[model samples]
Target: MWLEQMLAAAGRSGAFYEGKRRAGQYFLRYELPRTEAQFALLESLDRTTLDMPADCI
Candidate 1:
């Protein structure tokens, strides 16, 4: 969202150019892959807090 806002501020709305493209490439190559691993870890969890309440802590 911040990136989109920055692009819009620069009149590049909904378009990824140069640095934006590089940022997206970096995310896809690095950060995006972490999501699958994180999700796998979460999926392996035993639902320990499925019914937990927000204020419980």
Candidate 2:
């Protein structure tokens, strides 16, 4: 969806297209993989949060 939008924007402006293209590539390369680790960490959460001692708050 975003790539399609970026490509559409390329038809409108070169600079805007390049910027979005580079940003999207960066996100896909560097940021996308973080979701796996983040989701795994999230999945590890069980009752620990809810069971925390009231005094800690």
Candidate 3:
């Protein structure tokens, strides 16, 4: 699941131009591990939090 999210973000980064010339631009490449342990480790650093109102629950 975490890997999927990472790949999706990577895809949104756009394409890569090796020898093309540009004024001032850059491209980043994101690589995610394919192992469950790796995903767990990555997710542990950035866990999400949910907030609910007192009367909502």
Is candidate 1 or 3 superior in TM-score?
A: 1
Can you give the lDDT of residue 25 in candidate 3?
A: 21
- lDDT, candidate 3, 1-57, per-residue tens: 443344445534433322121211222223323456778878787543345565776
lDDT tens readout by residue for model 2, 1-57? 656666666656567778887887787788888899879878988777799899998
TM-score of 1: 0.47
Runs in model 3 lying further than 4 Å from the true structure: 1-34, 46-57
Per-model TM-score, in order, reads: 0.47, 0.67, 0.20
Badly placed stretches (over 4 Å) of model 1 are 1-16, 47-57
Question: Which 10 successive residues of model 3 have the least lDDT summed?
Answer: 18-27
Is 1 or 2 the stronger prediction by TM-score? 2
Each model's lDDT comes to 0.66, 0.77, 0.41
| Predicted candidate 1 versus true structure: per-residue lDDT over 1-57, tens digit per residue | 535634545645454455675675677688877899879978898676776887896
What are the candidates' C-alpha RMSDs? 6.7, 2.6, 11.1
List residue ranges in candidate 2 displaced over 4 A: 1-7, 10-13
Local error of candidate 3 at residue 23 (angstroms): 42
Candidates ranked, most accurate by TM-score first: 2, 1, 3
Candidate number achieving the greatest TM-score relative to the actual structure: 2
